[model samples]
Target: MTTWDLAVVGCGPAGSATAMGALRVDPTLRVVLLDRAEFPRDKACGDGIAPQVVDLLEDAGVRGVVDGHVPVPRLRLDRGAFGVDRTMARPAWVIPRTVFDQRLVEAAQAAGATLRRHRVRELAQPSSVVLDGEVEARTVVGADGAYSTVRRALGLMPGPMAVALRGYAPTPANRANAQVIAFGTAGQPAYAWSFDRGDGLANVGYGELLGHRHDRPTKAQLRERLDVLLPGASDGGTGWKGHQLPLSSGRWRPPTGRILLAGDAAGLVNPMTGEGIYYAVATGFAAGRAAAEALIAGAPASAGARYARATRRLLAGHLRHVAAAAGLSRHHRVIDAGLRASAADQRVFDDLVELGLARGRITPTMARGLARELAGAARRRPVRRRR
Candidate 1:
């Protein structure tokens, strides 16, 4: 078996991005990407790509394919009777995972990484992977998602996680270019979403943290909510599908030995919004760079440590905030109040959205606004004297 410099398991955004990032740094590095599914395979997702994701895709040499996506210039947030609609300064795009993932796979191949369609069954010592046979690699990256065989092979148990179900409905003529997110009812700690694919179809779904104390919404409940929000959309639950999201809780432990994990395999999804693509690409790039550097330096053992440090540096603060938000979301009434406040205050709305997207941090001004809002609510409460 030909020993390769890197073997990336899973060819989704993370795996492909790892291969592409590695080869871009050193074209001579031999990289092989393996996946059980072939290109153009559908994956259950929200199908919404943020602006930062576009930047990553462009850097990976897949910008041309993005033109096929539907431009989403506006975002709508709804919580009970309060709602806010705002135009994104940088527009996002809606594209099916089948189409989007294939482009990334093609880009990885174009970057000189070999693509193999095989299911990885086991992991061997000294950075080797076993499939139909043993293939030695100087380093290995686990980009496989939530139910990552690679992560389990490394004996890493994930912390808190989420389960999401999404399906497509015919897009309403009036909502062709808008994206909508609706917060779940009190105590649910989840949200439902609808993204207009601009191809006469809208992606609608709901997600909740696994093991949450509150009851998880059923497909029927999700359908009913979609009907209320989009009216006549998703009325019959035609094509609903479910997937797992391994949320980051800021307690990540690096995989034992030399194996490196990135993307969902490492539980890198944003807890606040269940967004995985951006983190996948970011961590995949970091893993690739770290692996390439370690391989060139003849220090495979250092790869895990280096990758861990890089991930901490990149995601520690964001993960902390997201974890906090996830915890607070358990009290849905607080979230509802926050949403109402956001609807009434533009700065509050931007800050809240930015934090949810991991685009920016909470500023002092936003904090002050929140404090004032809380104080006012307290004053409005009728004083009750001890009887």
Candidate 2:
């Protein structure tokens, strides 16, 4: 058995990003990347690559892959009765996961991390993982996704999970540059989205929070809603694929010991926007740096604590707001009012967009909007002074 310095399980964005970050910190470190599937695998996602993802790719030296992707400079928020198109401060990209993930894997291999195609069966302590056999390592980073084998083997219970259904549709020539996010309507407790893929195609999807008041939509129901929202968008020939999104609602506990967890394995998805790519890359970077420093200090056991603290510092405030917003989402009327306000006020719309991106902290603009809404509601209340 060839002992390695570090072993990263799962070679998706999180895994590849971890390997790349770790190797960048220490070129001499021996790193092995493992995954069950081969390269160019397709993932069920809306494929909305946010600006933060582009930033991470650039930092990882993989910006070349995004060169030909469609640039989405604007986003339309639709709430049935009202809709508004707001220009994004930083443009996003619409790239299929098959292309995006493969590029990350190649970038990791280019950074000198060895890539191996093998299914991980179990994980053990003392920095050892069992695939075909027991492979010993000084440290292990689990970047596997929501239903991670590492997380399950380690007995880490996740928080609320969201289910999403998505598929590709032929894009209309006139709407090739359009990106739309539509809120749920007619008793549906989810949201739908469409992103133009820059190749006469669009990725359409819908997601709902499980265990909510309403039942999860069926595949046929999801397609039906997509057809209604995005007229003439879906081909109605291909089937929609569903995936689980593990949301971090500030209740998830981090793994302890020489082993560390990152990305969806750690339940780092945003509770509000269902955005995991940014958290995946961010946590991967943090885990890699922490693991490297711990190894260099000859205290591999401290890696978990370091990673936990770093991730909390990076995600605590953001997740706090996400949890609050998710709570507000439970009230349909509140969301409707907020959407109306956002559509009418550009300042409110920009603030909401910023909040969705997690780029800014709570600001006065948000507070003012809430206050105005409350004041208007008070004025609309009927008086009972005669009694």
Candidate 1 minimal-lDDT segment of 10 residues? 126-135
Alpha-carbon deviation at 178 in model 2, angstroms: 2.4
* Model 2 spans with C-alpha error above 4 angstroms: 126-132, 173-175, 186-188, 212-217, 228-232, 236-239, 377-387
Please give, for residues 1-387, the per-residue lDDT of candidate 2 as tens digits: 778888999887889888888887788889999888888898888788888777877876676868778798878877777777777777778888899899888888898899887788876664454444657778888888988888888787778888888888777665568788888765635777888877877888878778763666677776777677666667742446988898877455578767888888989877767878887888888888788878888887888888888877877777777677767766766666667667667777777766676434446776677667766766887978875
Question: Candidate 2, residue 69: CA error in Å?
Answer: 1.1
The TM-scores, one per candidate, come to 0.91, 0.91
lDDT of 2 at 41: 91
Q: Model 1 over residues 37-107: C-alpha lDDT tens digits?
A: 97879988998888788787687666675776768988888877777787777778888899889888888
**How much RMSD separates candidate 2 from the native structure?**
2.7
Cα RMSD for candidates in order: 2.5, 2.7
Clashing residue pair totals per candidate (backbone < 3 A) = 0, 0
Give lDDT: candidate 2, residue 369.
74
